[model samples]
Target: MKKFQITFKGQVYELDVEEIGSATPAPAATKTVAASTPAPTPVKSAAPKAAAPKAAPTPAGAQTVLAPMPGKIFKVNVQTGDSIKRGDVICVLEAMKMENEIMATQDGKVSEVRVKVGQLVSTGDVLVVTA
Candidate 1:
């Protein structure tokens, strides 16, 4: 058996360890002592801010493109009145440390761009409208 002292996060602890032979299993044990310093005061967090407003509903006969996942708009490749084809890269989404290309699902003229660069978006959030 051996005794050792350990300091962590400004707190001190004492430990006791016993050695066992290869054929014998060691028993688990733990001991804690009251800290000498007073406990820290709890911090109060500020209330969460309201989320950004979503874009207005799509115009009649217009097809809408939505975000595939929650992420920041890294770049916008197309704008309102721009013509697009199926599979065209519409914007770049930065999610999980990766830049994903948001593509057009069908060919059409962009009637509205609902998002801008650096805007945070969530899955199924309207991003663009086409007609």
Candidate 2:
């Protein structure tokens, strides 16, 4: 039997594990217990604020850039009236602890910046509009 200690979310726990091999017969039953410890106090988070207002409609014939995945907007690289070309990085998205560059799909003038830094977005959510 091997003993191990692990810490998770500021809580420490002890564990016992038994290893068996194909050449060795397995025990019919086994039991293990962890050292008891007082539970940690629960944290209270503030109530969520209301959703932000929706962005204005995209201009006719404009190309809208959409979020590729659910993440927080790490940075916005372009603003309204900025000229951009195909493959230009429009913004940076932080998802799963990785930074992803959101690029423009078509060339045009940025008509609107629909999201801001630190704002959470979902897949298919509009990020920018270009015309």
Per-candidate TM-score against the hidden true structure: 0.60, 0.59
Colliding pairs, model 1: none
RMSD of 2: 9.9
For residue 131, give model 2's deviation from the true position in Å. 0.2
Per-residue lDDT over 1-131 for candidate 2, one digit per residue giving the tens place of the 0 to 100 score: 67777665555667877776767755556655556855667444445566888878776788899999999999999989999999999999999999999999988999889999999999999999889
What would the TM-score be for candidate 2 when compared with the true structure?
0.59
Error of 1 at 24 (Å): 46
- Deviation from truth (RMSD, Å), model 1: 9.4
User: lDDT (0-100) at residue 3 of candidate 2?
Assistant: 70
In the predicted model 2, the residue pairs found to clash are none
